[model samples]
Target: MKTDDLITVLARDSSPPWRFRPVLLAAICGSIIAAAALFFAGIGFRPDIAEALGSGRFLFKFVVTITLAVTASLAVGALGSPAGGVRRRGLLLAIAPALLAGAALLELAAIPQSQWGRSLVGHNARFCLTLIPLLAVGPLACFLAALRFGAPANPGLAGAVAGLAASGIAATFYAANCDDDSPLFVMTWYPIATMLVVLAGYVIGRKLLRW
Candidate 1:
């Protein structure tokens, strides 16, 4: 075939460029929803949730987790595109920590200084460490699978964002069962748990996401 004819045929057959946003949203959202369902089925909301709802501490717990989820989800989605990465500069991912730190400060000011350690060392440290990562499994897998559809220039960063998103979703679910309402508790243990997942994602993505 002539070069012109080949070019014309290829142009005629070419489809629109692939868009990953919708699928990315679906995968992340669906994983969270599924994990939430399991969480509710296995461990219902805090029995005192109605009373707890009135307190800023209780509500702030959700705020921290959900905000992390939102920002990390956005970052992960951004990283899915070849040029969408913000991790190289580390800007997008900074939002979660900054917000948490602000909350932590507010918590410190509101509570007794002597009791600071008590709030930070809430009763559920073991549970927080275990359950957050446990809940992260599905979302991490789903987010990683979603990344397969796009070209992420930094697989490790993309994967770490996915891990952050997963941990946020997981922590949100765990918050319902967690009796510790203090932002200090969340600020302390949650990051530790999420970092474990992020490390795992980095290692896994480095190996799995090679194009």
Candidate 2:
């Protein structure tokens, strides 16, 4: 083709590229909805959900998970944009962890040292590790799919944030069935499981999120 014709064609096509944030949001929300439905259908809330929700420990579980989800979601949205400034705001995700750490310390302070081990171990150590990452599958997959819509400067970090969001969603669902309401359990095992997901995200993002 002639240069003039090529230039004319290129100039004529000046439409904006598709927006990534909306796609990311939809994918994340859709995945969460699907995961929640599956979780409820397969493993509904604990038998004592009414009583559990009323308890301070039970309520705090939701607080931590929701905070992580909120902050990570914000970071994910920012990272999805090509403009690339997630670092500044991404630190906010630490709020949930910091709060949990503080609570864990307070719990340690109040309880006898002998029982600290039991509180950390809880009743669901095996199950907690298995189920949280298991539940994280859907949201992680969806977040990766969403990342495909945009160009992130650091795929690993983007993936990490995605993992964080997924972990939060997964933990929230897990909370419904988990009978162990100890802050010590949530603070310890939950973060462990979430970090596993984040590592998985980092590895996968390194491979898949590249342009």
Candidate 3:
């Protein structure tokens, strides 16, 4: 076929590669399963954790609401852009985690009460360290899947999807393990974590999805 003819055909038939579907499906399913497990496991809330952090109210509901909003916003933004171009995306992703970790560290360190500061530092560090790996896995999986199957026309969409998947997984695990059933815990920790994961997704999508 002539080059121009081939180009026309490719353009006319353009669609996201088929491999992405299964990866996306797995991510979605995994997130749902994680959330369900957290809910049914009799781990409803953690007042003690909230009290320690100094905010105690409707923890589960607050986290869920905030999570939904953050995830929706990130996903929408990501979907609006194209995927690939690794260098820039990767840098952005790398910076996100660093920024999140730094912010948490600074907050924990600046607390005036030594006892409380120590407690907060321990809690935040433990939570971040443990959750970061698990949270990263979901996005990494999605990135690999996107690459294997071929990225979407919009890389941003992939980032958003991956971000949501990452956040859901992280939140489920956080709920199950942390035991801090307070609005304060969710309000503070969840947003910070989500921001990190979304940034990671954006960077990963850019680098790994490069066509």
On TM-score, the leading prediction is 2
Question: How far does residue 121 in candidate 3 sit from its true spot (Å)?
Answer: 8.6
Clashes of each: 0, 0, 9
Residue 20 CA displacement from its true place in model 2, Å: 1.2
Q: Predict model 3's lDDT versus the native.
A: 0.50
Q: Any runs in candidate 2 off by more than 4 Å, and if so which?
A: 1-17
RMSD of each: 5.7, 5.7, 8.0
All candidates' TM-scores?
0.86, 0.88, 0.50
The positional error of residue 42 in candidate 3, measured at the CA in angstroms, is 19
Q: Count backbone clashes in candidate 2.
A: 0
Supply candidate 3's per-residue lDDT for 30. Answer: 58
lDDT of candidate 1 over 15-36, digit per residue (tens): 4365678879888878788777
Off by over 4 Å in 3: 1-12, 15-23, 30-125, 147-150
Report RMSD for candidate 1: 5.7
Candidate 2 per-residue lDDT, tens place, 85-178, comes to: 5777757988899989988888889899999889989998888898889888899999988988777667898898889999999998998889
The C-alpha local distance difference test score for the whole of candidate 2 amounts to 0.84
Give me the displacement of residue 194 in model 3, in angstroms: 1.9
| Candidate 2: clashing pairs of residues | none
User: Per-residue error at 101 for model 3, in Å?
Assistant: 22
Q: Where does candidate 3 have its weakest 10-residue lDDT segment?
A: 76-85
lDDT of 3 by residue, 1-211 (tens): 9755764565456565454445555545555565545445644445455463453323443346334534443443333323323343444344433443454455456555555434443355456445644544644464445434643455544664466546655565555446544333444666666667777677776666555
